[model samples]
Target chain A: MKADPKGVLTGEHYLDGDFACAEGALAAGCRFFAGYPITPSTEVAERFSERIPEVGGIFIQMEDEMASMNAILGASWGGVKTMTSTSGPGFSLMMENIGLGAMMEVPCVVVNVQRGGPSTGLPTMVGQADMMQARWGSHGDYEIIALSPNSPQECFYVAIEAFNLAEKYRVPVFIMMDECVGHMTEKVIIPPAEEIELYPRRLTNSPPAEYLPYMPEDDLVPSMIIAGQGYKIHTTGLTHDERGYPVMTAEAQEKLVHRLINKIRLNADHIIHIEEEDTEGAEVVVVSYGISSRVALAAIDEARAAGIRVGRLRLITVWPFPEKRIRELAPKVKAFVVPEINYGQMVLEVERCAAGQAKTILVSHGGGDVHNPQDILEAIKESIK
Target chain B: MEQSRTEIKITGFGGQGVILAAYIIGKAAALFDKKEATLTQSFGPEARGGACSAQMVISNSKVLYPYVKRPQILVCLSQEAYNKFEPELISGGLLIIEKDLVKPKPAENGIQLLAIPATRIAEELGRRMVLNIVTVGFFTAVADVVGEEAVRGAIKDSVPKGTEDLNLKAFERGFQYGKNLREHGE
Candidate 1:
C-alpha cells in the first residue's frame, strides 16, 4: 500500500534527526502519538504535535512516561498506528508498560533518542549505552525489533521501516537513536507517497461470533480486530489464551509465551537488516551500528590505506542480533573490533556470536560523545597484530 | 575551499541566533550547493547569560566524525564567545568577528581576520535581529566555503515569510562590506 499523501512532506529538507523521525512516523500512517517531552528527544514530540493537527491525527501530551507508553498501546488497539519518543530516564520509566505492549502483542513504535545514562547522567549529551536495554529491558523471554540510524537521512528512512515491522509482526518496535544522531542537522530527502510502500493492518475476516483474538494463522502472528468493531475482546498484562481471558495455569503460560517469542524468532531473517563491506577473506571486521558505524568507516579507510585487510559490518537493525553472520565471520576473521559510544553493550553479543573462534576487541567509551577515529584505528591495528 | 573537509565554529550569547547562523551555512552547503554538511550544537543547563556555540563540518563526501576538534574557521559575535573559543582555532585559520562587540586578542602567524559591524549594519536595515543574517552574508562572500547564491537561497528559505526582504537587505549590506575589504587588499 502507498503512504497517505496528506501525511507525506515530499521534498529536500535540511532537518535534524528528531524532526526527521517525526516526519517519518507521519508518512508511515502513524496517526496517534502520546509522549512527555524530554531533552534530546523533545523535538520529535514537538514536531508531531505541530504536524498531527494538519493531518487530522491525535497528539496527546501525557503527564509522564508511564502514561505515555500505555496511551500508545491503547491507541493502537483503538484502530490507529501509534508512537512515543523519549530519552534515557524517560525510557527507563516506560519499560514496564513496554512489557505490557509486548505481552498484549500490540503494534506500536517507541523512539529513544538516547542520552548518557544510569540515572539522569547527562540530559543533553550523546550515548549509545541503551543498546542492550532495548533488547532485554522490557522483561522475560520476549523478542522485539530494534533499529539504529546513523544520520538524519537514515533516521527518516529507518523510522518508516520500524513502523512497518511493527505492523507486520504485531510487536513493539524500537528506534534506538543517540543524542548525536538526534541533534545533528543534515539534509534529508523524503520521497513521494506512491514511491513509499506501507504494510496495511491485518484485520481478521472472520465474523464477530467466530473471531478468536489470540489465535494464530500458521505465521505465529494473529490477526487483530479493533475495539467497537462489533467483536467482543478482553486483553490484559496477565497471561491470556486465544479467547483473551486470563489463565494462570503453567500450561497456558507456556503456550502464550512461546507464541510471543516464536513470532519474532521464526521471522528473524525478514526483520534483520545489515550493511556489509569487503568482508570476503578479511583479517579483521569492524562491527558497529548507528553513528558509530559512520565513525568506524573512517578508521576502516585508514586501516585499508595502511595495508590492513579490514572489513565493515554496520547494523541498520541492531536487535535480533545478526548471530548467523557474526558466527560465520568468527572463524574466518582474525578478530572483530567493536566500537560503540557505550562501554560494552553490543560487544557482548558480538563476543557471544564469535564463541572463542575469534578474539573480540571492544573499543569502549562512557559516552558523552562519539569515539575518536584514531582510537578505533588503533584498535583495528591491534586486531591485526 | 577545495579541501576534503572544513570545520567551522560560530559562537555568541544565547538569543543571538548563533545556532541559526550555523544552520544557514550548513543548509546552504548541504542542500543548495549539493555538498555534505553536519551541524551540531552544545546543549546543557547553562546560566541565563551563557555562551552558546554551534559546530559544522562541510565536506565533499559523507561526514564521519561530527564534532569540531580544531576549527579552521571561527566566527565570534560576543566578547565572551571570543574568549571561550579563540584558542581552539587552528594555526593559519580564518577568524571572523563583530568589530563593535569583540576586542580580540592578537593571534599567532598566518592567521586571516575579517571584522564587520554586523549589528550596526542590521540596525541600518531597521532590525537588530538580522545581525546573524548579516554575519552569514559576510561569511558567504569572504569564507569561500559555500557558494554566494546558495547562501542567499538558504536565507530566503529559512527566515520568516514576511521578513525576506529585510533579511536579504541585511545580507547585501554585509556581503558588500566583505567585497570592499577584499577589493582594497585589506
Candidate 2:
C-alpha cells in the first residue's frame, strides 16, 4: 500500500537521524506516538510532537518510559499505528511493558537511540551497548525484531521497515540507532507518497460476534480488531487462548509461548537483512551493526590495502540475526572479527554462529566514541594470523 | 588536493553557529555538489557560548567513518577553539580562522593559514548572527571543497525564510574577501 499523503514529507532534506526517524514513522502511517524525552533520543520524540499535529495525528508526552510503552500498545490496540522512542535508561524502564506488548501481540515500533551506559553513563555520546538488551531485557522466552541503521538515511528507511515488520508479525519492532546516528546530520531523500510503500494494519475480516482476538491464521499471526469495533476482546500480559482469555494451564502456556517465539524464528529468512561484501575467497570477515558497521568499513579498507582478503557483513536487522549466513561463511573464512561499542554483545552471537568452525575474534569497546579504524584493522590482521 | 576523502572541523563558541556552518557545508557537498558528506557535532553541557564544534567528512565514495579524527581543513571562529583543536590538524592542512578573535603563533610548515574578519563582516552586514554564514562563504571560496553555487544554494535553503537575502549578502561579503586573498597570493 502507498503511504498516506498527509503524513509524507516529500523532498530532499538535510536532517539529523532523530528527525529523519520521526519522518519515517510518519510516512509509515504511525498516527500515535507516546514518549518521554531523554537526551540523544529526545529529538525523535520532539520531532514527532511537532510534526504529528500537522498530520492530524497524536503525540503524547507520557510521564515515563513505562507509560510510554503501555500507551503505544494501547494505541495499537485501538487500531492506530503507534510508536515510542527512548534511550538506554528509559529503555530499561520500558522493558517490563515491552514484554507485555510482546505477550499481547501489540504492533508498535520502539526506537532506541543508544548512548554510553550501564545507567546514564554518557547521555550525549554514542553507544551500541543496547543490542543484547533489546533482545533479552524484557525477560521472557519471547522474540522481537530489531533493525540497526548506520546513518541518518538508514535511520529513516529502517524506521519504516520497523513499522512494517511490527504489523506483519503483530509484535514490537525496534529501531536500534546509536547516539552518533541520532545526532549526526546528513541528507535524506524522502520519496513521494505514492513511491513509499506501507504495510496496512491487518484487520480481522471476521465479524464482531465471530471474531476471536488471539486466533492465529496460517502465518501464526492473528488479525487485529480495534477496541471500539463492537468486538468483545480481551488482552493481558498473561498466557491466553484464542478467545484472548487467560487460561492458567501448561497446555495454554505451551501453545502461546511456542507461537510467540516461532513466529519470528520460523520466518527468520524473510525478517533478516544483511549487507555482505566480498565474502567469497575471504580469509577474514568483520561483523558489525549500527554505527560500528560504518566504522568497521574503514578498517576493512585498510586491511584490503594490506593485501588481506577481508569481507564485511553489516547487519541491518540485528535481531532474527542472519545466523544461517554466518554458519555458511564460518567454514569458508578463516576467522570472523566482530566489533561493537559494547564490551561484547553481538559478538557472542557471531561466536555462537561460527560454532568453532572458524576463529571468532571480538574487538570490544566500552563506548564513548567509535572504534579507531586502526584498532579494527589490527584486529583484522590478527584474526587472519 | 581532490583525494578520495576530506575531513573538515568547524569550531567556535556555541552561539557562533559552528554546527550550522558545518551543516551548510555538508548540505552543499552532499545535496548540491552530489558528493557524499556526513556531519557530527559535539553537544557539550553548556547551553550557549561554550565550546562548540562540528566534524564533517566528504568523500567521492561513501564516508565510512563519520568523525573527523584528523581534520584536513580546520575552521576556528574563536581563539579557544583554535587552541583546543589546532593540534589535530594535519601538517599540510588548511587553517581558516577569524582574524580578530584568534592570534596565532607562526604558520607551521606545509600549513596554509587564511584569516577572515567574519564577525566584523557580519556586524557590517548589520547582524552578528550571520557571522557563521560569512565564515561559510569565505571557507567555500578559500577551500574549494564545494562549489560556490552549491554553497549559495545551501545557504538559501538553510537560513530562516525571510532572512535568505541577509545571509546571502553575508556569504557574498566573505566570499569576495576570500577570492581577493587567493588572487593576491596572500
Candidate 3:
C-alpha cells in the first residue's frame, strides 16, 4: 500500500550515483548482483554488497564483468533473480557472455550506466552512444528488452521490468541509463516493501532422470532446472537436442534458434512500451527516451501552448522497437522527430518504422549534453509547416 | 503564444552545490507546487575543482526536455561560471553573481543583474554548507520560481536522516539572507 514511506526511501537518504542503481536493483528484488567495481560504477557493487545480505541474498564482486554475468546466470539457474551492472567499457567486455545468456536461455538483467566511449572514452562524463550497441552489441539474431530510465524512480521500476522480462522470456536484458540519471538526486517515493510485485525465477519440477533443458513444449521457454538439484541438466551454447545433448545437425539448430527467437518475438506486443502524450491529432511527434525524453515532453507542451500540434512517443522499452505502434501512429502524425544524446541512433529505428509515411528528422546531440527543448520545438515548427 | 515554461541554469566551480541548488529549486517548483521541473547535471571528471553546472526547467505543465541552450535565469557562483554563462543568457534575461567571487555587470539592454553576498551570508550563518540553499533562496526571491514553503518542502524531501536540523536551519537562514539582500541596495 501507499505507506508514509517514512524511512524506506534510500536514495532520499543520501547515495552517490552508483549506490542509487544498487538500491533500485535491491528494491526490484534482485537476489544476486555480481560485478567488479571500476571507478564510477563502484558504488553499485558496494551498495549491492551491503544489501544482498539483508534480503537473505548473495552479492559477488567477481574478477570481471564476464565472470559477473556468468555468476548471475548461474545464480538465476539456482532459481534466484539475478543482475549485474557495468559501465561502457565493462559492458563491451561482457558482450560475449551476454551472447551466452542469450543462447543458453537464461534470464538475467544487465545494466550499463554508460559513460563516454569508443573505448573508455570518458569514464565520468555521461553518454547515450551505447543506444545501438545495447540492441546489437552481442553477436546473434535475437530480440532484446532494453529500457532507458530518465530518473531514479523510473530506474527502480525499470529494473524490476528488466528482471521480469528476462525471466519471462529467458534472456538477458539491458538497462540503458546514462550516468547523469544514475547519479542525479530527487525526491523519489519508494512504495512500501509489501506493494512490490516481484517475479522470482521459474523453476522446473520434472523428474531428475527425465529432465531435458531444451525440451520445447507448450511455452516456448523450456523450463530451467537448477544445476545441482538432483537434475541431469546439460546446457550449452551449441545447438542441443531435446535430451540436452549438443548436436551439429542443421535441423536441430533451426528448431533451437527458432524457438529462442520466437519465444521473445511472439511476445513483442506484451514487451513493447511507449508513453504517449496528446497524440490524438498531432502533426509533429517527437520520439525520444531516457533523460532526453524529459526534454522532448516539455518541448511538446511548450509547442502546444504556442498553438503547435505536437506530441511525444517516449519509449519505456526500446529494444523490441514499438514497430506496430509506430506504424499505427505514423499514419496520423505528419512528422517524427528523434532527440537523443547520440546523433540519430534511435531515429534510425523510427525512420524504419515511418517508412516514408511520415517525415523523420533527427534532433540529436552528443558528448554528454542532452538535446535542448527549443531545438526540438524548432524542429516541430519546421515539421508542422 | 503564452509561455508556460522557464529554463534556468546554475553554474559554478566544484563544491559550490550547483547540482544541489538545481534540485532544491526544481523540486520547489515542480513537485511541491505541482508544476513540472526536470534537473540535470554536467558530467564532471575532476568531481572536485572542475567547472560544474546544473540545468533546471520549471514549467506549469509536463516537462519534456531538461537541458538548457539559453538560460532565462543564470546564477553564477564563481567568475569562471560568469565568464562561461554570461554570453549564453538570452538578451535581456537576468544574471546574478556572487559579489566576492565575481564582479557585477550592468545589463546592456535586455539583461538585468544582481550582486549578492551569498558566500558571506552563508558563512555568517556559521555553516558554509548552506551556500547552495542560500542561492536557491535568492532564486525564489528574484524569479518567483516557487514559494518559500515549496523550498522548505524540497529541502525536507531532499535531505536525509539526522541532517534535517542543519539543512532546515540552513534553508531558513538562506531565505532570510536573500530577503535581506533584496531589501538592501545590493
Candidate 4:
C-alpha cells in the first residue's frame, strides 16, 4: 500500500537521525506517539509532538516509560499505527510492557536510541551495549524484529521498515539506534507519498461470530481487530488458545509460545535484511551494525589499502541475527571482526554461528564515543593472524 | 577523496548559534552543493551558557567516520574555543576567528588565519544573534569549501521565517569583508 499523502513530507532536508525517524514514522502512517522524552532520543518525541497536530495524530507525553509502552500497545489495538522512542534507562523501564505487547500480539514500533548503560551510565553519550538487551530484554521465548540503521538517511527508511514489519508480523519492531546516529545530522531525502510503500494493519474479514482472535492464518500470524469494533476479541498476556481465552495447561503454553516464536523464526529468511560487500573471496569479514558499521568501513578501507582481503557485512536487521549468512561465510573467511560500541555483545552471536569454523574477534568500546577507525583496523589485522 | 574531504569545526559559547552555523555549512554542502556532509556536536548538559563545539565533514564520497579527527578548517567565536581546539588543527589548515572575541598567539607550520568581527557586523545589522551567519559567510568566502549560492539557499532554508533578509545582509557584510582580505594581503 502507498503511504498516506497527508503524512508524507516529501522533500530534501538536512535533519538529524531522531528527526528523520520521526518523519519516517509519520510517513509510515504512525498516527499516535506516546513517550517520556529522554536525552538524545527526546528529539524524536519532540518532532512527533510538533508535527502530529498538523499530521492529524495524537502525541501523548506519558508520565513514564512503562505507561508510554502500554499506551502505544493500546493505541495499536485501537487501530492506529503507534510508536515510542527512548534511551537506555527508559528502555529498561519499557521491557515488561514490551513483553506483554509481544504476548498479546500487538503490532507497534519501539525505538531505542541507545546510550551508555548498566544504570543511567551516560544519558547523552553513544552506546550499543543494549544490543543483547534489545534481543532478550522483554524475556520469555518470543521472537522479535530489530533493525540497526547507520545514518540519518537510513534512520528515515528504517523507521518506515520498522512499522511495516510490525504490522506484517503482529509484533513490536525495534529500531536499535545509538546516540551517535540519533544526534548526527545529515541530508535525508523523503520520497513522494505515492512512491513510499506501507504495510497496512492486517485486519480480519471474518464475521463477528466466526472471528477467532488468536487463530493463525497460513503464515502463522493472526489477524488483528480494533478494540470497540463489532468483532468480539479477548487479548491477554496469559497463555491462551485460538479463541484468545486463557488456558492454564502445558500444552496451551507450548502451542501459543511456539507459534509466537515461529512466526518470526519460520519467516526469518524473508525478514532478515543485510548488506554485504566483497565477501566472495575475502579472508577477513568485518561484521558490524548501526554507527559502528560506518566506522568499520573506514577500517575496512585501511585494511584493504594494506592488501588485506577484508569484506563488509553490515546488519540492517540485527535481530534474527542473520545466522545463515554468518554460517555461510564462517567457513570461507579466516575470521569475523565485530566492532560495536558495546563490550562484546553481538560478537557472541557471531561466534556461536561461526561454531569454530572461523575465529570471531570483538573490537569493543565501553561507550561515550565511537571507536577509532585505527582500533577497528588493528582488529581486522589481528583477525588474519 | 582524502584531499577532497574538508573537515570543519565550529566552536563557541552556547547561545552563540555554534551548532546552527555548522548546520548551515553542512546543509549547504549536502543539500545544495550535492555533496555528502555529516555534522556532530558536543556540549555540556546545560541548555545554554556552556562551551559548545560542532564538527562537520564534507566529502564527495560517503563519510565513513562521522567525527572529525583533525579539522582542516577551524572557526572559533570565543577565546576558550580557540584555546581548546587550536592544537588539533592540521598544519597549513585554515583558521577563522572573531577578532573581538579571540586572541591568537602566532601562526605556526604555515597555518593561515582570517579574522572577522562577526558580532560587530551583526550588531551593526541590529541583530547580534546572527553572528554565526556572519562567520558562515566569512568561512564560505575565505575557506572556499562550499559555493556562496549554496550557503545562501541553506541560510534561507534554515533561519526563522522573517529573519532571512537580515541574516542575508549580515552574510553579505562578512562575505565582503572576507573578499577584501583575500584580494589584498591581510
Candidate 5:
C-alpha cells in the first residue's frame, strides 16, 4: 500500500540520522509517539513532538522509558502505528515490557540509538555493544526482527522497513542505530507519498463474534484487532490458548511459544535483508553492520589496493542473523573478519555459523568511538596469514 | 579541490553556532553542490557554554569514514578551540580564525592562515549570531570546497525565516574579505 500523503513530507533534507528516522516513522503512518528524551535519541522524539501536531497525531512525553514502551504497546493495540526511541539505559528499561509486547503479539517499532554501555558508560559516544542485547534482551524463546542502518539516508528507509516488518510479523521490531549514525548529518531524499510503500496493520476481517485472537492463519501470524472493538478479548503475557485465555498446562506453553518463535524462524528468509559486495570467490570477507560497515569499506579499499581478495557482507537486517549467507560464505572464504563497536558480539554468531569450515576473526572495540580504519586494515591483512 | 576528499573542521565555544556553520557548509556540498558530505560533532554536557566542534568530510564519492582524520581546512572561532585543534591540521592545510578571539603564534609547514573579524562584522549587522554565517562565507571563498551560490542556497534553507537578508549580508562581508586576502596576499 502507498503511504498516506498527509503524513509524508516529500523533499530533499539535510538532516541527522535521528531526525531522518523520525521523518521515516511519520511517513510510515506512525500517528502515536510516546517517549522520554535521552541524548542522541532525543532528537527523534523532539522531531515527532514538533511535527505531530501538524501531522494530526499524538505525541506524549511519558514519565520514563518504561512508561514509553507500555504506552506504545497500548497505542498499537488501540489500532494506530506507534514507535518510541531511546539509548542504552532507556532501552534496558523497556526490555521487560518489550517482552510483554512480543507475547501479546503487539506490532510496534522500537529504536535504540545505542551509546557506549554496561551502564551509562558514554552518553555522547557511539557503540554497537547492544547487538546481542537487542536480540535477547526481551527474554523468552520468541523471535523479533532487528535492522541496522549505516547512514542517515538508510536510517530513513530502515525506520519505514521496521514499521512494515512489525505490522506484518505481529511483533515488536527494532531499529538498532548507534550514536555515530544517530548524530551524523547527511543528505536524505524523501520520495513522493505514492512511491513509498507501507504495510497496513493486519487487522482481522473476521467479525467480533468469530474472532479468536491467538489463532494463527496460514502464515503463522495471527490477525490483530483493536481493543474496545467489543468481541470479548484477553491479552496477557502468560502462556495462553488460541482463544487468548491463560492456560497452565505444559501443552499450552509449547503450542503458544513454538508458533511465536516459528512465525519469524520459518519466515527468516523473507525477513532477512543483507547487502553483499565482491563476495564471489573471495578469500576473505568482512562481515559488518551499522556504522562499522561504512568504516570497513575504507579498509577494504586499502586491502584491495594491496591486492587482497576481500569482500563485504553488510547486514541491513541484523536479526535472524542472515545465517544461511554466513554458512554459505564460510566454506568458500578463507576467513571472515567481523569488526563491530562492541567487544566481539556478532562474531560469535559468525563463528558458530562457520562451524570450523573457515576461520572467524573478531576486530573488537570497547566502544566510545568507531574503530580506526587502520585497525580494521590490520585485521584484514592478518586474516590472510 | 582536485583531491577526491576534503576534510574540514569548525570549532568554538557553544552558543556560537559552531555546529550550524558546519551543517551549512555540508548542506552546500551535499545538497546543492552535487557532492557528498558527512558531518559529525562533539561537545561537553553544558548546552550553551562549553567547547564544541563539528567535523565534515566532502568528497566526490561516498564518504566511507564519517570522521575527519586530519582536517585540510580548520576554522577556529575561539583561542581554546585553536589551541586544542591546531596540531591536528594537515601540514599544508588552510587555517581560518577570528582575529578578535584567537591569538596565533607562528605558521609552520607552509600552512596558510587567514583571519576575519566575523563577530565584529556580525555585530555591525546588529546580530552577533550571524557570525557563523560570516565564517561560512569566508570558508566558501577561501577553502574552495563549495560554490558561493550553493552556500547561499544552503543558508537560505537553514537559517530562521526572517533573518536571511542579514545573514546573507554577513556572508558577503566575510566572502569579500576572504577574496581580498587571497587575491593580493593581504
Candidate 6:
C-alpha cells in the first residue's frame, strides 16, 4: 500500500496501541514474532498473529516467555530474522534464553514494553524503571544492544535498527520502549517503501558440507546454514566447538564463550551512538535517553536560550556504554548530569566514564509523575554553579 | 511579532476513546500541517472514573515540551473532565463539550464554547464506537488543522477494512454539526 504523506486522516476506523506495535514489527522486516499474550503485551501478540501471516512472515504465540524466547532463537537458527515483545515478569522468564542468544551469537530483537515490577507491578500502567534491567537483566558477562524510543514512530525505526544491528554483529538485540512510548500513537512517518533498507540473512557459498557456524577469520560475525539446508550444523546453550557442537572439555568451552562475549564487547566502539547539542565548550552537561531525552532536550535548549552553557548527551545505544566518548569529553566538560527513571544506574557508568574528571549529579523520577524540562534545567544550573 | 504555541486538551471518561481523538489531532497538526506538536495522556491509578485528558501542543517551531499546562482549546466529553481541566483553559480559548454527558455547565464566559451530542450522533450513525472519530471530524472542520487529504489517509488506516463507508458518513455529519452550531441559535 502507498503510504499517505500528509500524516493525518479520520474515519470509522480505530486501533489500540498494540496493533500499531505489531505493524511496526512487520514493517521492520521481522519474519517472526514469538510471544505469549500477557495483559497489555497480549495486544502485540494478538495483532502479530493476524498481521505477520499477511506479510508472508511467521507469528507464533508460544506457551510462555521462555518458549517464546527460544522459539525466536530457533527461527534465527533457521536463517530468518526473528523477534519477541514482552513486559517485566515475562522479561524475567526470558532472561536465561537471552543469555543463550548472547552466547550462541544469534541476531534478533527483543522488545520490553516495560510496566512496573518487582513482579507484575502495574500491568496496564507505564514505567521506565527497567532502564538498568535491560543492560544487566540476563545473567551474562557480555554486551548487548539496547534502544529506548520516546515515541511509537521511533519504535518503528528503532525496531528496524535493532534487527539491523543484530544481523550486523550476529548478536541478540533489545528494544526498550517503555509502556508510555509503546502504546502511545503519533504521526509516525511510514517512510515510503523505497526508503527502507531491509537486511537479509548473510549466507555463504561454503555450502552445506563446508559451513562452520562458528568459524570466521575476517568479519567478527560468522555465517550459518539452517537445519534442512543439508548442513551438518550444531547449536548449543553449552559452550561449543567451531562447528557449534558442544564439547565436554573446559578448554573448548572457555575459548567459545570468550570469543562470543568478546565479539560484542571489543566492538563496542562501533555500535555506540550518542547525540550531542551545543557541547562545544559546555560547562554543564545533561545526559538522558528514551522519552526522558525529550525533556532533556527541552531543558538544554531552554537553558541555552536563557544563556546557560548547558549541553545534552542523548544515548542511542544504552548498552556497551558509550564510555569512550564520555571519557574523551571528561577533561573538557565541567560536570555531568544523569537523569533516568532509576535513581543511579547510568550515573554509575557516567561517573566511571568521567573517571573523576568531573562531578556527577543524578536526577531521578519513578512511576506516578515524570519530571519536566525545568527540573532538568534547574539541575544543570545547580551542577555548573 | 511572535507566534504563541497552541496547546489543546481533550478529555472524557476511560471508555470514550479520548486518547485516540487526541492522537489524531496531534498527528494532524504535527505531521500533516507541518507544525510542531506533542501529545500526552493522563495515566496512573485513578485512570478509570476520574477525568482522562490528553494534551497536545501545535506550533510552527520545534515543540519545547509535551506537557500542556495551559491549553488554548479544551474538549470535554464528560462533566468531570470539564471541571478538572477547565482551570487550564487559556484566555479566549475554545471549549467544546458533549452536551449529553457533561452537566452543571461551564462558567467560563470569555471562552468560546460549543456543545455536541457526540455519542448520540454516533449511535444515530449506527455505531457508537466511533464517537471519538466523530469528535475528530468536528475538530478538523472547526480548526482546519489537518488537510482533507491527510484526514482521509488517517481514516483509512485507523478504521478496519470493512467499515469505511459508515465512518465517512459519520465524519460528514459531525463536521456539518460544527458548521451548524452558530446558525441555529439554541
- Docking level for model 1: medium
Task: Report lDDT per candidate.
Answer: 0.92, 0.92, 0.77, 0.93, 0.93, 0.75
Model 5 sits at an interface RMSD, in angstroms, of 3.3
Q: Write the per-residue lDDT of candidate 1 for residues A1-385, one digit (tens) a residue.
A: 9999999999999999999999999999999999999999999999999999899889999999999999999999999999999998999999999999999999999999999988998889899999888999987879999999999999999889999999999999999999999999999999999998999888999999999999998889999999987998999999999999999999999999999998988888989999999998899999999888888888889899899999989999998899999999999999999999888989999999999999999999898888999999999999888
Chain B TM-score of candidate number 2: 0.96
- Evaluated against the true chain A, what TM-score does chain A of model 4 have? 0.99
Return the DockQ of model 3: 0.31
Task: DockQ for every model, please.
Answer: 0.65, 0.57, 0.31, 0.70, 0.62, 0.31
Q: Listing every candidate in turn, what is its Cα RMSD in Å to the true structure after a full C-alpha superposition?
A: 1.3, 1.6, 4.0, 1.2, 1.3, 4.2
Per-residue error for A98 in candidate 3, Å, reads 0.0
Per-prediction interface RMSD? 3.3, 3.2, 4.8, 1.8, 3.3, 5.8
What does candidate 3's lDDT look like per residue over A169-247, in tens digits?
Answer: 8889898888777766544555666666655556777888777788765768777877777887778887788877899
The clash number for model 3 is 10
Clashing pairs in 3: A294-B64, A294-B65, A295-B64, A295-B65, A296-B64, A297-B64, A298-B63, A298-B64, B92-B110, B92-B111
Chain A superposition TM-score per model: 0.99, 0.99, 0.93, 0.99, 0.99, 0.90
Q: What is the TM-score of chain B in candidate 6?
A: 0.89
- Which stretch of 10 consecutive residues in model 6 chain B shows the poorest summed lDDT? B149-158
Off by over 4 Å in 4: B1-3, B43-47
lDDT of 5 by residue, A63-139 (tens): 99999999999999999999999999999999999999999999999999999988988989999998988899988
> Which prediction has more favorable TM-score, 5 or 6?
5
Question: Which digits, one per residue and each the tens of the lDDT, describe model 2 over residues A1-385?
Answer: 9999999899998899999999999999999999999988999999999998799988999999999999999999988999999999999999999999999999999999999998989989999999999999988799999999988888888989999999999999999999999998888999998988888888999999899888898989999988886988889988899999999999999999999999999999999999999998999999999888888888888789889999999999999889999999999999999999988899999999999999999998898899998899999999877
Candidates 1 and 4, the one with greater lDDT: 4
Alpha carbon lDDT at B1, candidate 5: 14
